[model samples]
Target: MDEKLIQRLESAIARLESLSPGSKPPSGTLDAVSAASEPSIVAYDDLLVEYVVKVSLAAEKIGGQVHDITIVLSQAFATQKELLMKIKQTQKPDGGGMTEFLKPLNDKLAQANNMSEGKRSDFFNHLKAASESLSALIWIAYTGKGCGKQKLLLLTSYFPIFNINLASKQQLFALIFSGMSMPIGHVEECWQSAEFYNNKVLVEYKNKDPYHVEWAKALKELYVPGLRDYVKAHYPLGPLWSTTGAVVSAPKSAQPSAPNPPSASLANLASSSSSRPKQGQGMAAVFQEISSKPVTSGLRKVTDDMKTKNRKDRAGFVSSGENEVQKSAPKTAAKTGPPKLELVMGRKWVVENQIGVKDLLIDDCDPKQTVYIFGCKDSVLQIKGKVNNITVDKCTKMGVLFTDVVAAFETVNCSSIEVQCQGAAPTISIDNTAGCQLYLSRESLETSITTAKATEVNVMVPSSDPDADLAEHPLPQQYIHTYQDGNFVTNPVSHSGG
Candidate 1:
């Protein structure tokens, strides 16, 4: 809504176009990169292969079962039926064309799977699990997750649900087992557990509705720390994995480019008439482009004016080797304006051997001390102490985490942000700002808990998601009373606030 934000976003859109507008298909395109026509002219960037390697290495850690993941991922490419069909048609007299293209991935996954059980350390297993999880997430991105878009519509044109759902076991297995994720049976079963669902619901309580809150909670639990963590760690910033799942469920395409013969204001009315077309166009562009570059539209909107006049953009982009020019912004910014941001509670971290909360109360409002929390949709709880690390077990009804150290209240940062999951419906919950910041290496959980009795305080009140899981915990009656009266106080700390 702010004019300044609009200008900044426009600048960002220009930048994206100049940097990576994506490979536009020839008007009735054919074999633009096929070797049959030109054997010696392989593009040979190895970028696509390199991306596959990163995804494979990350997933194979779990069990080296990637075939299932790939099969699910193939679903995302369903709309590219022409592309898929072409690859299939080009098969060398045998059924090994696409399969052969995926050979390296299969071998990598097999190697990850073949490691002796005893020899596979906990770290190794964690890495593998992370990779497999990422593969699934990537698959979801390809198909827009569950939302119907151009490719989804094209593929499921006759399906009643208006889209192909990956909730089924067979489809899930196909995606993961093919040197990608594990299997739908395994991943979905994880969602079916009562305890897992309860814990997941607790975390996702901040936003969303009740209808499928339980299912959504389970999905988030399976994704965060479990699958998303590995993918984020291994892939490049602008790699395909990040955007794959989010793009699948994208809104419909831009209404076939508005029929091309509209008057000025009529065109505006037509485009704004529905969100589906706009979202579809946006999602399509995002999915196609993420393969080569990072999506920073939500990260920051730096305008040409800002780059020239604003000191902050210059300081951040100039010194960091980023191209802070105005021509690289997202094209969607032209329509939607700058991203809207929401402040979130992020994980705790240590800096220079000092165990402290990222969003801590500053002595005098220092920007470095002013850490920005991304992705969280609800209020955050910041606990500080001499504590060396943190592990998020669960939250109380009051939405606070009690720890052994004297924790301090921290400042919060909010941004008007746009949520983009790269290519498909993000496999990861974009709501958990805590975990989201972890990807930046700027935040992490507080110290691990030991010799401490953790407890939660439940507050029975209207919440973001009314049907969210309710965990039982004993709370001090007096503390509850104080909080109700808006006079809550922090318990006395054993140590001074950091």
Candidate 2:
């Protein structure tokens, strides 16, 4: 929201476009570049990839509900797309016909006679712009298509303090997996509501609901060395707020004028209304142009002629310079897929590196991967954390136990998840986590938890009192409490407090 900050981020897009143009970068390049201990690109240069992924997420119909970040990002995507169009236009002959290619030669002759060097300089400028634009697009497109979107969306949904939501079923996902966090503190922001015409305000927590405190406690568990860690190690992605999966619109056949940014409104980039059209749609359209189009048979003769001419020219210009030993050395190809991965349908697997996967399925199997996500709605997940940072989804007859150091656990659009926190610092984030509880435990105390998106999250934190009897302090109605008595235990209620 700061004026100076807006001006800084606003110039970032232009700097990125000016740097290079070509197809987008390779799929793993962005991640590899970002994750390196030392990054090659400077501060705002990172925003380029993030915006492209946002566009790709939009193409897949995901929206980040945060207003300011999305507005800035959407406009950035538009600006880059327009620049790419110009680069493409510059490569093609103007006024296309049989006479188009001859114009360059004619211009060269005209320049030689008139002693005008502007055409010569202009030729190099176009090449420079195209090279930069094409390269930028390639990196952006690869990230948008290959980034693990499902995990990214799930990670940001749990914290109640953040203003974000899933707008439609398209944004909804099933089959999450995870475990463990420790409850820590209370919120002291001193937020309040207004009174009447007396012009006074009442402080919040005046009524002091115990249930509210419990919720806050659970939420705080997620706040520390949290999802931000996951994001920092990857792209600086903004949280997605909506799920209205918009269709990727095809590119227009007829050329349109390049989109121009508002000259006086660099500060207003935060306005949600100022965002450009769906960029993922435009990127997808461009992708179609690059991938699906086939060269015509008629163009083959022209291509062969160009290659033969190049060969003849090279042979005439240079003598042979290759040594017999150097020529015999084998060329190396790049490696793809996880180099250390070992797989099977059976259990017992160990992996110490990050695993990038999509539409991933693992049923009746043990856990130990970086991220596991749901592609189909009916997909089931088994969240046994032999690895770290997981989401437990669709908890029907499932025993959700929090053990060890689980930074955050979020559940949404699934059946029922059993609640049991026996871990150190666990935050159970319930966003649209419907159904009911199958269990709750005592160790949930001192764990920070937050809730958002979901209508209700059923938490079952039991009393760990040694001397106190059940008859002395009656349990609250929200608890599914039980004790060693005359078989008289019912309803979930009455949790412990700090």
Candidate 3:
């Protein structure tokens, strides 16, 4: 009756119209079916099986069988939609020509609505029969031959209990487009002539053989209560659950409440009075003298200090070596070398040199080399003499013997050194005790200066902590060139492994 409902009716009818003569089938039906039959379909079949399992699980959770309830529920939704469309499209004196066309449909819809629930169920059963006919028609359309009786039976067995009227493309579309304006007879005629399916194919209406007594019993159990108690007990949705809509309830039990404790002062006095002995004060005297007092802050301080020490000991940071990296330096580089750099690919790299200007070049590499470099921590190492294919691990050890080296790819092993730049200016300066001050262009340096002479004995230092004084004490010069193991025509020879 409302505009929105009317629009839905109109849309449904239009959809039905399109489905009138011939409409498109489900987009991937053929592919899905073909793929289902192939050996390779196992992979996709796994996905389908998973969904089917989930469907069964959901049905079990709701106390119903997946194949049964879905049919009735879907039917209910379709019937509701049809009733709505009919109500909206009901013709009036002022209604337009479209309304006149919708008049007969309104009467049929009213009749369908007035039918008893059992009658509706019968109608749905009829719709299901029609749907099977349609399915066979489609098979014939695709294969140009009528499906056999056994094939029809197999198809029927596989078909889940879905409401054909609710699920049908033509019916749903008609509900939307014509607003129940078209007569039911016309709708039936459209489906009859549609080439969508081959009616010549045999049809099967039952999941089980009709002659089976148990099959009839199961069918009866679906709608009846009490008579099928044994069957209902085994069914997931339980026979009684659907028919009687009854839920099991447990007997209620009263819980007792705990008695409240006496106030703190009263409890304390009572404890003192009860504990009075020959060596202690009398109970009456202790009770008379008792008075409330606040806890002192000094006691709390002692307790807090004890807790702090306990935590410190538990964490292992109380030991000197465990917290070595966090200690302050004496403003002097270790005789060994600066801390090593961990190169992690994908993360940004900051490589700069102190003392003098040096050129460093980098290039994209092949898959193997890319993996080796990118897998590195912090930043990748540069192998000496190898353009882009060498491993830094094979070129050099963590030592700074050269001083004049400008640039060379060399392998070095060292740990990282952390310094805090305490409230100092952002710019950093590299200075040497040997009377030479190096101005680095950037905060960090990354290079393999193997060919040029070593400039400094310092390299492999981490960025200063946000509060450290890196500007005051400059980094030492690191070995820029490699101490070649032997004379070779080429600087870098490929090594199989690091």
Candidate 4:
């Protein structure tokens, strides 16, 4: 086991123990205690109801903040025309300029002192951060600069909340349904703006500097996950009729009836019956009636209806005549093969599911095109010309030789992958990968390489002397990060060579 993981588990156990009852009572004594004195165990249905109510209330509060942030973003876009124009005119990717441009928007956000405090403060802060991310993304897509840190901030800050494995469903749903609902229009507009930038501005600089395309691509990636979450959270409500069901009634004889005088005149009997309590008129009967009906919600009804429809469809298909089933089976069984290497929209090259193929090549790639290699095993791919970016994903024992990448060369979720770059690549990123070997030619020696959750990464660079062997540098896999003076400072583990 990893030492860090062991420490984390130990810490979690300590916390749990601290929160547990101080000492366990004798086993028999617990059962002997009076049930009335013991704390009531909340039912799952009651807890779920409480949680839903709390989430709904929180959503409303957060929705207001989101609405305010949307207005701020819109105002910034409209009033800061001069700054935007300056951003367009600027040729360099200056992080400082981007910060300055965002100051006004941040100031407006800071003035929202009406926001409540405490744990809710964290939610408001996240809302502000998300707004800033969205605004920065739009600006980056518009100006085609500030692609480095701003894009990284957006990915790191907001993207993880959308991960189902990392966040609770309620949390994810609340954030998407509340924080993003109001700003969805703006998000769409930003997407359109990015597409326009990709088609118009980046196309002109296809040969000289196509790295600006990364901003557009990053914006698109950010938008897609949030959009997916939005769809999940905003599923249509079930019809009201679906929640309605026949109420179960008690038997007629079992119901309580009014008392009648046994030996009295007819008029006296009527008077006595009128004064007595009638059947099913008291609170107990009302309670009984309420308990007899099944509890359900519209959402649950819709989900159940959908499941029933699916089961019925399957049953109908299974019960079909043999000839009819055989005739329809061919259509269901026939499936297309996984996609091969192809260019999409004249901008992206998708290569997928090629196994044990050695001769894969993209000889005529332009600087505006991005290459995506996915699920290729024991394959060697060669790109003969410059491309905007390249991503190698989920591959094993794959070798990639590329001439140049104007933006970034990224490898994600792969093992035993080797990449060689003969020309310049501004950035090379390895993520969730293992056993990566990167060979950088003299012309590409200045490339910036970044890695996260990766191991066994070695970079080979040509030595100063032409006759000397290439110098191999292994990237540090372990690091220590400490909070100091407000920010975290990270340092790689020390070795004897240092």
TM-score of each: 0.20, 0.26, 0.14, 0.38
lDDT of 3 by residue, 138-226 (tens): 11111112212322222223332253323343443443344321122222333443211111111111221232222223322222221
| lDDT score for residue 230 of model 1 | 35
Alpha-carbon shift of residue 73 in model 1 (angstroms):
3.5
Best candidate according to lDDT: 4
Candidate 1 lDDT by residue in tens digits, 283-379: 6765565655565643877676666556554554435334644445555346334322222233233211111222432122211121222223333
Q: Write the per-residue lDDT of candidate 2 for residues 218-240, one digit (tens) a residue.
A: 22221222222323443333212
* Cα RMSD for candidates in order: 28.6, 28.5, 31.9, 26.8
For model 3, what is the alpha-carbon lDDT of residue 392? 23
What overall lDDT, based on C-alpha atoms, would model 4 receive against the true structure?
Answer: 0.55
- Candidate 2 minimal-lDDT segment of 10 residues: 189-198
- Kindly provide the TM-score of model 3 when superposed on the true structure, using C-alpha atoms: 0.14
Give one clash count per candidate, in the order shown.
77, 58, 72, 0
- Give the runs in model 1 whose Cα sits over 4 Å from its true position: 1-35, 38-41, 44-47, 64-67, 74-152, 155-498
Provide the lowest-lDDT 10-residue window in model 1: 433-442
Better by TM-score, candidate 3 or 2: 2
**Comparison by lDDT, 1 against 3, better one:** 1
